[model samples]
Target: MARRTHKGEDDGTTSNNRLELIIEAAARMFDAKGYSATSTQDIANEVGLLKGSIYYYINSKEDLLFRIIEESHEGALRAIATVSHLDVGPLAKSYALVTTHVKVFHDDRVKHSVFFKEFRSLSDNRKEIIRGTGHAYSLFLRSILEEGQQVGQVDKALNPRMATAGIVGMLNSMSFWYQDGGSWGPENIGSQFAEQVVLGLVSEEYLLSSGGRKVLLETIRGELA
Candidate 1:
């Protein structure tokens, strides 16, 4: 038999909804005020609950921060998983990764702001877990670059690790300055970033080749479509 929550529905569904509300509230507070400066009362107030009520969903403020960070990374991990399995070349895969990443940040700007700004507030053990996830995401990008190199699509002399770091850094920075109602929306920003990545990293010879140009054009069109 399913356990009933205070709200009278199944425990699982109600609990999940409450947890999401708490996390969303916490994310906004953490993004506006630094993690150390925000209190459980503030989070509870944000969600219209008693201070102690938050304890039902999370043990501590640090736990809330950890959950927010984890949620942000989980979005990226899911995007990577989806793109990794696609039957496309490195350029298309790379474009998809960029667009997906940008969309995630755009969709949850407050959560991602907390993710970037308050991650170091986590305990050592929790920090390690976040680091592991981040490193795996980085390796995914590196693998795509490596594949591009092998196929003569990317610049042979470019360092995959460095390239990955640079691209990731650029994408993550979007959380800082991207406006929700700005003229350039997530898709536009993503496509432009993808174009920059391809144009910057692809071989000069490939860029000049008629066949290579056609392939790149088709890849961008397919992603936009």
Candidate 2:
């Protein structure tokens, strides 16, 4: 059975909203102060609720940390899921995924920091869950790479596993330096980042080859089919 959190409210009212607020506040606090240094009361205070009120939503500070990490993962997965279902080929899918990945992180600075940095605060079991989610997302990217290779748009010599890891590492590193205070918007940053990723992964020759086109189409069809 699927586990539901504190409130029975399915409409995202009452308990769900409170939980969202709690998670958001926790993400901010975790980003500002390292997760170990931040307390449940700090999170509760950020949300303008009593510290005891937080227990009604989560069991401990670690749970709140887990929730923040999970939110970013869910956002990332949703972005990938959307691109994975697109009618476009592997190249486009790659572009869309990169674009979404950059935009989501750049747009949600606090969650972005927690996703890349504060995940370590989770308990071993919770850390495993985050690892599983991270692995699944990497596999999803690799699947796209595999499709690209098989269809001929991507280099068959390209190792999807390493390449996927590299791409994620590159993108995630931006959190360390990306300035939300800058004049650049998320769209501009995302597009620029996506272009770099796409350029690195897709060769001009591959884009022109019949094999490349075939592989690209097949990759999308295989994923969506």
Candidate 3:
């Protein structure tokens, strides 16, 4: 039996599936055209539904934007959770973080693009909600760097907060230039980025030490595996 959504629509579409389609369509339109330039009618045209029908899935266009940003943030949190459980050192964990971060952007370019590009378009309340999630993700990265420093793998002198922000900024920038069929695939770009971020943060002594080499190789293998 087809379940009807709260909107009372009986198109034989599940509510979750319908909502996903609406959100995806909105993300695509918002990514290509600026949020301010994108209208409800535009989303409707992309989704092949009437403008009024969109309201059945969301309260307003702003709501759709908020959902997209929230979804991306949720994905980041999930990635952080996955990396946190790995039975590896901070360097390996950091490598996993970078790989996961870049892959998310590559996998969902439109959502992440809308997330990075149109975040400010959300209302104050929605902005606060998204900001909280962003801060949590930031703290997670900072914690990873701090753990690395404590273990003598990362530079003790480096500020974890600043390093975290820098790494995140570098990975997030991919949404601006990364194309679907780019010469460098997501794994290659992610692996190279992991090298840059992980090696840059580790101390010279650690890099030269046997333990450091083992850790580095293990981290690389974990990323490849």
Q: Give the TM-score of candidate 3.
A: 0.89
TM-score of each: 0.90, 0.81, 0.89
Candidate 2 on 151-219: residue-level lDDT in tens? Answer: 776767778899998988988888888887688777787767666665567755775663654564455
Residue 207 CA displacement from its true place in model 1, Å: 2.3
Tell how far residue 115 is off in model 3, in angstroms.
Answer: 1.5
Top-scoring candidate (lDDT): 1
Model 3 C-alpha lDDT per residue in residues 67-156, reported as the tens digit of each score: 888888878888889998888888888888898988877777889889888887888988998889889889988998898888898899
Tell me the tens digit of each residue's lDDT in model 1 across 157-185.
99999999999999999978888899999
Q: Give candidate 3 regions above 4 Å deviation.
A: 1-8, 11-13, 211-215, 218-224
Q: How are the candidates ranked when ordered by lDDT, highest leading?
A: 1, 3, 2
Give each model's whole-structure lDDT: 0.84, 0.76, 0.83
